[model samples]
Target: MSKDPEDRLTVGEVSRRTGVAISALHYYESLGLIASERTTGNQRRYPRYMLRRISLILVAKRLGISLTEVQHVFDTLPLDKLPTAHDWRRLSRLWHTQLEAKKREIEQLERELMGCIGCGCLSMKSCRLLNVDDELAELGPGPRRLDAAQAA
Candidate 1:
């Protein structure tokens, strides 16, 4: 905390304290994952508590949570209000479930990738990894759905 308890941190101070880039902090604000007050001169002043929010956002991003998902979590709180302990608990539970699902998906993909490596053929018609057989060739060309399904 700053020596003066009432003194708010500027964007630079927050960026320095959190190790988050200033532009990334602005982007998080734009994405509604964090909020700040604009000074009369148009400078951004962030409460010290915003550090926690930024930290949470960084952690979520590391876990493959999209900006949209981060915004959804922020939406649970009132604007400019920092997360409470209860809120953190709830968010942690949600993230854990999502992380588990992503882990399973990665494991499945790794298994499929191993299968593909076992057979050097990456073609849709013959790649056992994709489970694409001759019958599916009539449906489309390429790994039509293998790549798209993972993203969606």
Candidate 2:
């Protein structure tokens, strides 16, 4: 007998409820981010808990987080059970830190671009931000002063 509609959802139902495509849900399953059970006829069926996980995956991806990174976060939760309130809270804290770091990096990049406009690579002798002096050559190629990122 088929499961009642309230307890488990068919792939189409999940897609309809979440606005995610059936193929995407299958992709998520292949990535081990979400799981489903097979019916006797080998049809896919998902527990309602997947909605929460899918929502988180979508939101994290929107923030530029890769699915692999999100899977790493999910790995920290117990494999045998659905995620709990505390689990989501911990994930939120971890993502909040990552997002804050990214925000800072973007801000720094913007400032450096502004500084670059002023420097114009015109003053090789005095441009600390762009030109790599002989003194910094020992550290190898690439921008010598970017590690500190003082932005000129």
| Model 2, residue pairs in steric clash | none
Model 2 C-alpha lDDT per residue in residues 1-152, reported as the tens digit of each score? 22455777889988998899899999999988888888899998888778888888888988888898999998886543667889888988899999999999889767656767855765534554445354666667666667648666
Question: Candidate 2, TM-score vs. the true structure?
Answer: 0.74
lDDT (CA) per prediction:
0.79, 0.79
Candidate 2 residue 61 C-alpha distance from true site, Å: 1.7
Instruction: Report each candidate's C-alpha RMSD, comma-separated, in the order given.
Output: 5.8, 6.9
Residue 143 accuracy (lDDT) in model 2 = 62
Q: Which regions of candidate 1 deviate over 4 angstroms? A: 1-7, 128-152
Q: Local error of candidate 1 at 137, Å?
A: 3.6
TM-score of 1: 0.77
Best by lDDT: 1
Clashing pairs in 1: none
